[model samples]
Structure formats: structure tokens, C-alpha cells
Target: MSVELWAQPAMMSDPAPEQMMEHILKRVGDIPPLPVVATKILSMVNDPDLEVDDLVSVIQKDQGLTAKILRVSNSAFFGLCRTITTVKEAVVTLGLNNIRNQVIALCARSMLETRAEGYALEAGGLWEHSLGTAFCAERLSSTLGLKGTADQVFVGGLLHDIGKSILSYYVATRFQPILRLVDGEGLTFVEAETQELGFDHAEIGARVALRWNLPEALVDMIAHHHGPSRESKNRTQVCIVHVADAIASMLGLGLGVGGLENRIDDEAIAHLGVDDQVVQDVMVHMSSIGDLRAHIGIN
Candidate 1:
């Protein structure tokens, strides 16, 4: 968790998986806090009786956030008939759910929009990948008649790989061996990580979400996004994000060092009642969305 752990070569010198996981959990304390506004917005969104006025009051506290909301609301992308001049107006025009997605996106941008050398991601690469997955999950939810949970799924997609950020530091130190395993052994990045470091990013990410006190569903999505975890009860949401992550990778939105070394869970697809036709339709829809970065306000 601290630099001291990494200071002693003996500590990492062929440690077992349990030791590696212990180290990861200790480091969770060092993971940065979610932006205050993001935390507030997430709490509001989780509340069943949330009101636009409540969200407006929370957003109003941050002038910069309020401005961003207004700007996006008035942007041509939204195609609003009239200009939005106030937080309340923006909320009304964009709807509380849409605003919630934007808030999560904006808040996550700072943390996710950076290069992760271990993953061979350039600056902003992970952010693009996360955003693409988020959009894909949202679209998939809508297409499958699970619209009620679309927003939650979007957040899950955005955060599915969050553990990668934390693992990057350790990965940087072991990058060469991990890459060797991935390239020469034909192992996926997560597999390489598990082989070389004892734990994978998914497990680390789930712990990070738990440490941040995020929702249980989001935690499951992050933890089991590569596949379904044994403890996952929200199978629909998990499968949605799992398929979404695969779709994003297929699109080459943010491939990182892992490239396309991933598999789409056919069972996950079937679980969501998505057939090949639906997959093709989703691909077409994603292709037509043109400039996903702009649509999601990633720039």
C-alpha cells in the first residue's frame, strides 16, 4: 500500500497469490477518494426517491460542474429545442438520469484519463475504453428491455477496469515478464497478471470498489466483468458489462497493451437474450454513433 512495501525487493520476490492479494488490499487505502461531487451524485442516484431539485442543489455547490452540465445540455449533441440557463433547467432538459451518467463520467475522467504504462495505454486510452463500454452497456440495456437499470449499468461499465489503475504501479515493475507471458505464452493480460503477480486486476478492482463504498452491483460488475464471479447475484448486470467490455475492445476504442486478447462470454450474451442478430445490430449502432468521445464529453 505504501512505497515501503515496494521498497524491499524481498517483499515482492516471488510472493504467493495470497501475499499479493494482501498487498493489494493494503494499497486500497491509498487509492484516491472519489470526487466529492461524484460521491454525492452517486448517493442521490441510488436513492429511490431522488428529486431533480435534490440533484440541482448538490450540483449547484460546484460552479465548475454546474457550468459543464449547462454546456453539455446546450450543446448541439443533446439537440435540445431551447437553451438551458440554470442547473434546474438543465436537469429538466437532460433528465436526472442523464445528468447522473454525465456526472459519473465527468468525475471519473480525472482518475481514468491517464496513461497506464503497464497496460501499454496512452494517456486517455483507458478513459476512451471505459466510456465506450459505458455507452455500449447503456445501449445494450435499452435494446434488451432492461432500460430501468441502464444508468446503473453505464456506471458499472465505466468502472469495470478501475483496478487496472491501481495495479499499474506494480505492473510497471513487472511489465517485461508480464508482457513476455502475454506475448510468448499467448496469455491474456489478466492471465499474465495472475501468473506473474498472483492476483488479477478484476479482483483488485472489486476490492477498490468495496473500499470506496460503492454499490454492491457495481462491485460485482467490476469484479466479474471478465466473466461471472461465483458470488455474483446480479447476473444480468454483470453479463451486460461483460459483453459491453468485449464490444468496446472489438471496436478498438482503447486497446491498450492487451489488444484484443479477450473473449465474449456466449453464456453472458444468451443470459441477456442477445443473439447474433442483436450483436450485429449493436455493432451497427455503435458504428453510427460517430465520435463517441465527443458524445460522451471525454475530450
Candidate 2:
């Protein structure tokens, strides 16, 4: 089938709902902006030459983020033996990257919790799905020994389908035909999107991440989370996200026209040398991921 690629286009004037969806999603203005403090923390974390104190300074600047990090460190999740009250203490105890990741996750809550009309997905549903994907990515990374920080993997998984947020707003009203195509014709979400909307969420999301000044690795992960074969510096991360997304959607953690043909990313699996045993283990571990969904911050 000859298909016009869902390749992202430059932002333009108001157009059809499909184009508007692309414009709104590809441009950062449509989605909630990451907090300035969080942005700074991400910037420093992404820098290889950044000093430890620089990261501490950025964390200290956001009093709320600092407090949240400290609280989570002390929480049962980390199982820290001692209490951590200061930014330096938290950083030293939790690792700078870990703390930065925690802050980013916390900060994302506010931005992702708003209602989006275009996709018919509620605030809690999207966040739940994102969180689930993050958890799965971390687990999968450990299983695969992928060369990247777990926190980075978590962030990649969480933000992978952020374009869907834009889709919900711009294309939801016009997306029925896309869903119909998926159901009646058995097309995947990307294929159905292209058939009906002229673009897919992955393309729009990649552009969104780029506009946000997110790390290049992260932008690619989000862009190709659905299409791991697409160009990406971290193909393992892309595959992790793809599997994690498939797992979450299959378990029905969040709503996004679930039951779409779950793409397995066989090429990436073979490239990464992941054997059947690892896949089995992931399946066993995540078998109950859905039941645990309510335990997360999702409403």
C-alpha cells in the first residue's frame, strides 16, 4: 500500500484537524510546558561536564521539587536506612540522576493531569499509562542490560506517547474514522492515524519533545516508541518503550483505543540479542502490572 509518511512537517497556520493536531503536537505551545526549575535540572543532568554542585543548585532552586525528592527518598519506595533532609544529602544518597528523575516525574504530574478532549482519555488514565510504561521500561532495561540510566529509560517510557496528549485535543473529534479503520480494517494506531488524520502521534510527539529542549536521545525514544525500527540512537530504549507500551495497553492501564494490533518489534529484539527467556521473564513479572495500576498516583 502506498502511504504518505507520517513524517512531521513544519508548524503552519490553522489547517484541518489532522494538520492542527500535527501543528499543536509538533509545537510545544499545545502541551503543558515543563516547569522552569525542572527544565534546568534536566539540562544539567543531560550535560556530561556538569558539576555535581550545579545539579544540587538547580534542585535547591525549586523548593517544592527539593522537598518532594527528599520525601520520596525517605519514603518506603527507596528503603533508605536514614532520613534525608537536604538537597546535597538527597543527591549523595539517591544519586544525582535518580533525584533529578524523581523530580521530573513529580513535576510532570501537574502538567499531565488536565482533561484532553480530542482523545477522550481522562487526566488520570494518561498519567497511569505513562507511569506503567516507566515502570516496565525500568524492569525491561535491567533484564536487557541496556546502556543507559534507569531514570532516563523511565523518562523515555513516560514521555513516549506524549504526542497522544496533543492528539486527544486536536483529533479526538475527528478520530472516530481512524479508530474505525483500526477496528474494521485491523490497522495499527499509526496506520489508522495516517489513513484518517494524515499523521501519527509518534511524529507529532517527537517534534514536541524536540521543541521542549529535551535530550536528543529522549526525543528519539518518544518519536519511535511506537516504531522502534525508525532511526534512534538508543534502539534498545526504543524497543523497551515499544514493549512497555504494548504491555500497558494490553493490560488496559489507560485508554487510547486499546486492542490495536500490538506490534512486537521483532527486528529490535533480534538486534538487541534478547532471547525468549528474557521475554518470558518480563511477561511473568508484568503479568500483574494492571492490578498494581491503582497503587500509583492515578485517580
Candidate 3:
């Protein structure tokens, strides 16, 4: 609240989560908007009674989106022998949910491809990392036998770091010291954030997602991803996303300002039942991950 608080020295610990969340919400405003097609598709698909005709009509409105969906369906990722020529055909073949997730993924690329200089993420770096995490989450969810759609988990992973975009301008100007602290001063990213900015990026990102009216489960994952121990409902989903992010960060797919300390979350690992063997399996499948990542066009 005071100038002194902004200049406070780095401490070994984090602040109370509630205080941090409040400050981030009060300080940040007017996040970038989701693409019109993405917003409309999210609204349509989320409606329980919406029919396939309704989805086809909406996809028809955006000619580019229709083509992209068809392309994605026929791509090696989906592995269909037949071509998907029409929006309705793709929806029928790929299923409504997978089509919806691809639309979101396409829109997210346009939204996040700009480099956020403040966080030291190059143009497209955040997009690539987000996509990789989403891919990882989808695989992990299937492995865990989770109840929800893997496509939804993939979308959650894609937008998990939307808050980084919200604070890019501030990080460029007011919080440059935070970056220096994290790198040269041997501080954890969260610790550096608390010392220099009076808050951390994860909470800031969570607030941005909340403002966008994303599902509360997603908002919770973005908010408490770093503090998975605090998450209650959908803890497995949150942990999936949390560990996915750590793995993405470690793989150097989109190394942002957050360094290697952003490695895998041990708590999330234990929470999700991901053990040494699972990690090895994921690594063995890295080539498959790369193929999927490339197909998503986040590269």
C-alpha cells in the first residue's frame, strides 16, 4: 500500500495468499480480450443443449476457423485416414469438444504470440510453452483416468499463464528490479516478485483469468498452481496443470524470465501420483510430445 512496501527487501518467505491476491486484483485492469470466434465457440459448446447444427452454423460464420479445424482434424495429430472437408464433418469425426479446444488453441496463438519483454519471454515463446503444457496435461489426464474431457484440460493448460500478459507492461517498467532479483540475486521467482512488486505473477494471472470469466476450476488452477497444497476441489486437475507447467518450463520449450527453479513441482507430482517411472515414461514419449506440439502450431 505504501511506496516502502514496493521497495521492501527480498525475504526468504512468501506473503499471505489472500493479501497478495487482493493487491493484484486492485492493481491490474482491462486484460486483452479473447478472439470473437473463440468467445462465441466457448459460449456455444458450454451450452448443454446446443446441437451440432448450432456449432456448424457458428463455425460457418468464421471461414478461417472452419478451414483451420478441418486442417487440424486431418493432420497427423488426429491420425484420420479420410479428409475432413467441412466444419460439420470435422465436428462429427473429431467430436464437438476436441473441435472446441482447437478453436481456443488457434485464438490463443494470436493473443499470446507477442513477446512480453517484461517477463523476458520472446515473441511466441509463451505460446509455445503454453501449448506444450496443454499437450502434457492431456496425456497426464488420460493416464490418471480423470473424469473430465482431456480437451478441456488442454485448454486450461494453454491459458494457464494468461496473467503473464496482464503484467508485461508493469514488469517492463515498474518491476524490472524483480527480474534482476530473480536472476542475479539467487531468489526464487515468487520471492523476487514479493520483494520487488509486493505480489507475484501467479496471483496476477489468476485475477486476469477471473476477469475473463473462465471456469472457476481454471481460475483456481491459475491462482494456486504454485501453492497446490492450498487447492481443495479438483485438486487432481490443478496438480496436473501445475506439474505440466513445471515440465514445460524445464524442457526449454518457452523458457521465460522464470529460470530453472521453475522445475517440476514435487508436491504436484505426489498429489497426481506421478512418480519416477511416470516421469521416465513422459520423457520416453518426448518425441511424441514434440510431434503433437508442432501439430498444434504453437511453434
Colliding residue pairs in candidate 1: none
Instruction: Summarize candidate 1's per-residue lDDT along 29-79 as a digit string, tens digits.
Output: 554678778877766655768888898899999989889888888887877
Number of the predicted model whose lDDT against the real structure is largest: 1
Candidate 3 per-residue lDDT over residues 1-299, each given as its tens digit:
22112323332244455654554455443334665667677556336676788878887888887777777777776677888888889888877776777788887775567676667788877778788788777777777776354655677788887767655655565456776786798888778876776666677877777677767677777776666754357677778888877777766768776656665677787777888776555555555655544565323
Q: Where in model 3 is the C-alpha error above 4 Å?
A: 1-32, 40-54, 61-64, 71-83, 147-149, 174-176, 183-185, 291-293, 297-299
Structural similarity to truth (TM-score) of each candidate: 0.88, 0.80, 0.78
Q: What C-alpha lDDT do the candidate models reach, one value each?
A: 0.81, 0.68, 0.68
From the highest TM-score down, the ranking of the candidates is 1, 2, 3
Q: Give the Cα-based TM-score of candidate 3 against the true structure.
A: 0.78
Runs off by more than 4 Å, candidate 1: 1-31, 46-48, 79-82
Could you tell me the lDDT of residue 122 within candidate 1?
Answer: 79
Best of the two (1, 3) by lDDT: 1
- Deviation in Å, model 3, residue 9 alpha carbon: 26
